[model samples]
Target: MTSNKTDLPYFSVVGIGAGPANLSLAALLQARTDQRIALFDKAADSSWHSSLLHPGVRMQTSWMKDLVSLVDPTHKLSFLNYLVTEGRLFAMINSQFDVIPRREYMRYLAWASGQIENIHYSTPIEEVSFVEGEGFYAISGGAPVARSQHLVIGVGTRPTVPAGLSSLPDDRAFIADHLALHLPTMSSDKTAPVAVIGGGQTGIEAVLRLLGAGFSNIKWLGRRQWFQTIDDSPAANEIYRPAHQQYLQDLTRGTRRRLVEDANPTGDALTPGVLRTLYQANYDRMLEFGEYPVAMLPGRDVTEGVLDGKDVVLHCSTAERLEQHRVAYAVIAVGRQSAPVPFSAELRERLDAGEDGDLVIEEDYSVRWKGMDDHRIYALNRARFSHGIPDANLTLLPVRAAMVINSMLGSELFQIRDELCPVQWG
Candidate 1:
């Protein structure tokens, strides 16, 4: 009757990656049960997109959508509580920002993580394998750290560089994250032009930072015909509510997928505040220098390119014509793909996946996998097509976490209720 750490009793849950997704789940489940639950993250410290915390850059999502507030407003870990405890509630209210700074969100996450129990930092879970008799063994550091009855994958995303830049040395082109680090080492010549490829918010932010730093020539290229902002209109917001999510559940999978594509502006678009700021900054520069520093190049689908001497050449196809742009540097701000689940080969085969080989996440965020009788696998921020926009957004994090917790416990500890909706969909 003895056991090592590998043979430890089955934990209630083992969450991979202590990002907001799994942190939300850990927060909501704190009071519900005394059963063992823990989060293991590869990062040595609690830093959420640390390098991307550019100055004056704010969160695209609202602060009210903090980890636990949306689901349980009265929860101790609510953002309001964080503000009060840190004695910055009044200062924050006076700032009157449309959205909170991402730095604050990161701090809040770290605070929440500190309060929670059994979070293993710097411990990267190498593989997760399932056995017939046992629940799930999560291996890390060449040993099984814990056995879990349930698994939650929240590995999050990484910056992606296009294959076109593969031939270039690392010194030339890089993802948006390295921009801040690269800036200090760059030449101080103000008129030296740079390019930000990809029209999403990240690209917009990069363009703004360069403009602010006195770069007279900056190219902001996006595939969309024109840069778009998040449509926070009342009607557009209707889709983000739980009622619409329930409606999405009823539609055929194909229809839901199509609608999810159409609902892009709800979360993935640029924020109006940032947009206005960029325009105003550009206008002020025009008044002072008689020309705007930032050039907006929309509808340019950058397919391939090469390094030409001191500059990088980007070949893009616009609707009307094909063109080549040369710049001192290129910043890739394209959208990110989901981080792959670290499921073992056997578990991967047993799990149901779509044509793209992505895990087929169910409505409850659970995956349909064979040989996982009572054990379950829940993926957070990995089901954009299946669960609509909310799947990859922070707007409904706690709600999703609560649903997972309920599913894991086989009881509705938190009743999900969203009534009196204005929009009705088939």
Candidate 2:
């Protein structure tokens, strides 16, 4: 809670988190010498997909979908560059697929992070508030810093656990986020059944990992009638084309949300290959012995579960009937919620008053706050409702980074037009 007014040599852009999204931004800004930028991560080191990293887990998207290719294909720090540096570029080319092992991808990201300067690791951003006179933000924590230009909040998502299970005492029930670290410690006794909840990518991946770990009995509970596959058709991906940007702009809010919801099953769901692998593994294990019996409890919800002696008694309500299953542990692969960013009382007050609360920005991603015309705060993942589905996911990291950089440079550095799309309608 301290403030300082000193003439600094550089105009700063402060990023709240050091995930792939913010990391991409840091790389883009690093090329510019006139501006100084800083990236902060609360973790001791850079990491992604910590859980669901089974022995053979592969990336759903190709290496071309990395942080820089979609934005700047020519960037030397792209994943292709990392592949070449690691001597895996030729091996990857021979594989005839763009995807690589998840562990290798993490290694690439870590290597890229090391090449960037002014990144503060192990330092968490506690709070960010604006100073009126300076027309800048005061970021407190990890060596006090302030920025006179812009602040990007890319903290990423939080794990979403079921409402009732939050207070459960059993250490056996876990989320997908911690699955990798905790899975190895699990007992391998055949009597212990592992229940995996959810049928999305993370859930399916977790189930496959558990089976790979030699777990005998496992159950998968999902609300969907069956596991869905993402639509990889060229026409479907056309939604990402520049022509569709105008279409997305014209739609109303409700229409835009519906479009996202409808398109999610095809774009964000589990890949067909991953699903096939899971099915094949289940069959293989079943043929050898009744070792990995995957009971697909579709259209079912886990109403209650508690520790009953040495087992977990799970009460589930299916579409037709209520059933119970006893298992050793449960893994909730429910994915994540938006991460919280600390805003000062002054900014929060303006949002509370509903004036400049729903701040609108032109396609450049400049945020409009009350009583502020020149000072713009650029938020990355927080604009999902306005910016479409690409805001939070890694799929749009490169595009978003290019836009942010373009806006900062006050010109079309990437040659993208400034036209805003039509307002979406329901």
Please give the CA lDDT of all the candidate structures: 0.86, 0.72
Residue-level lDDT of model 2, residues 148-237, one tens digit each, is 566777888887888755655546888876777786678858547889988888889888877767777889988777777878776666
lDDT value for candidate 1? 0.86
How does candidate 2 score on lDDT? 0.72
Error of 1 at 193 (Å): 1.4
RMSD of each: 2.0, 3.5
